[model samples]
Target: MRVLLDHNIPHELRRLFPKDHDVYTAQFLGWEDYEDGELLNAAMDNNFAVLVTMDTSLPYQRNIDSFSLGVVVLDVHPATPDVLTSRMDRLVEACSRAASAREVVTLN
Candidate 1:
């Protein structure tokens, strides 16, 4: 799956994804300044299968069903690398399921 990591997610987290999954950061895509909606749209336009983010309000702020891409919202506190790493299995599972779905999956 091609996953786009939202700006709020640490760039270092990309390295934790399964090797077969293509992961890119919003900053790497030149979308560091993009608003939530704009960033999601761009990810969809670029054929990103899923968007991993730490934005808790994104689901309420945007109509996720309107887009074709899947959204995985990481609801972790502090969001440190180790914390996120401990939840990689959940993240990967959500991303895998989301690759073919357009729903929002929240991982706490």
Candidate 2:
């Protein structure tokens, strides 16, 4: 799956994702300041299968069903690299199976 990590997530987490999948980040894409809707549109346009974000309100703020990309919203309390790393498997699984327009899987 091609996953796009949100700006809130640590860039290093990209390395923890499954080796077979293609993962990119908002920072890497030079879209760190783009609005959620625009970002989602860009992600879908690029054929990104999933979007990982730490923002809890993203699902509620945006009309996800309007798009065609899966989303994983990490809900951990302390979103450190170690904390996120522990749940990489779950995140990966969510990303792989997520095909809905809006899929928000919490990592807490």
Candidate 3:
């Protein structure tokens, strides 16, 4: 899957995913200013199949059906890299199975 990760998510987490899959960040896309809705559109336009975000309000802020981009919301504590790194496997699995259309996949 082509995955676009939000800025809040650690960029280093990309190492945990499959090298065959394309992974990018909001910062890398020059979309740091884009809100959820705009970002979703950009993702679709870029052929990104899934989004990994730390924003809790995204699911409620935008209509899921509009963009056709699946989302994975991380719930790791912001205290340290170790905490977030521990959840990388689960995130990868979620991203692998994510649908083509809009959907919110939450991970705690």
Candidate 4:
């Protein structure tokens, strides 16, 4: 699936996704200034299927059910390359669930 790495997530984390999953960061897309909803819309417009973020509040703040683009919350505090690397399995699973279900998938 085409995935967008939200601004809050470390850009380096893009390396965590599988080879088949095409991924890019908000900064790379020139969307680092976008808000949650606007970012989602922009990602959707560009045909991105899932948005990976560390901002856990996005699911509560946005009504994501109506959009085809799904949001996957990392659910990690003080997000770091090492910390996120340890949770790679959960992140990958959540991302797949988000894409297939088209809903908010939170890692806890």
Candidate 5:
């Protein structure tokens, strides 16, 4: 699976995904300035399978149904690397099973 980590997610968290999964960050993709909608569009256009983010408001702020990438929202404030790591198993499982556009998976 190809996972795109939103700008708010710590880049260090990329290391926690399964070894076979390809992970990239918005910052590394030169898309740190992209708004949520724009980032989702780019992820879809790039054929990213899942978009991992810490933005709790994303589901309410945008119509995810319009995008083709699955979204995984981490339910935690200040989603530091350690917090994300603790939730890595669920995140990885969500990524592995992600299919269909607009699929949403929440991990705490």
Candidate 6:
């Protein structure tokens, strides 16, 4: 799967995802300045299967359900590398399911 890690997520965390999955960060794609709606649209345009973000308010702010690509929102307190690393398994699972169905999933 082609996954996009939002600007809020640590760029170094990209290496933590499964090897079979291709992961890129917003900064890596020169998309760090985009707004939420534009970012999602760009992801879809670029054939990204899913977008992983730590912004819990994204769903409420944007009608993500209307997007063709999947959205996996991470709900974590103090979203540090260690905290996110521990939840990799669950995050990956959510990403897979969301990508498969083009659904939005929140992993806490």
RMSD of each candidate?
A: 0.8, 1.4, 1.6, 1.0, 1.6, 0.8
lDDT of 3 at 22: 88
Q: State each model's CA lDDT, in order.
A: 0.93, 0.85, 0.82, 0.88, 0.85, 0.93
**CA error at residue 39 for candidate 3, angstroms:** 0.4
Error of 2 at 62 (Å): 1.0
* Model 3 spans with C-alpha error above 4 angstroms: 100-102
Number of clashing pairs, model 4? 0
The superposed Cα distance between candidate 6 and the true structure at residue 2, in angstroms, equals 0.2
What's the lDDT of the predicted structure labeled candidate 1?
0.93
lDDT of 4 by residue, 1-108 (tens): 899999888888889888988999999999999988899999999999899988878888888987888789888865778988898888888888998889898886
**TM-score of each candidate?**
0.97, 0.93, 0.90, 0.94, 0.90, 0.96
RMSD of 2: 1.4
Put down candidate 1 lDDT per residue, 34-102, tens digits, no spaces. Answer: 998999899999999999998999999999999999999999997888999999999999998877777
In model 3, the Cα lDDT at residue 50 comes to 94
Regions of model 1 farther than 4 Å from truth: none
Q: Point to the candidate with the largest lDDT.
A: 6
Give lDDT for model 3. 0.82
Clash number for every model?
0, 0, 0, 0, 0, 0
Instruction: Give the better candidate number (1 or 5) by TM-score.
Output: 1
Q: Candidate 6 on 1-108: residue-level lDDT in tens?
A: 999999999998899999999999999999999999999999999999999998888989998879999999998987888999999999999999999999889998
What count of clashes does model 5 give?
0
Best-matching candidate per TM-score: 1
Question: Can you tell me which runs of candidate 2 are displaced by over 4 Å?
Answer: 100-102
What digit string (tens of lDDT, one per residue) describes model 3 on residues 1-108? 799989887778777788887889899879989978888999989899999988988888888767777988886677257887777788787776665435778888
Model 2 residue pairs with clashes: none
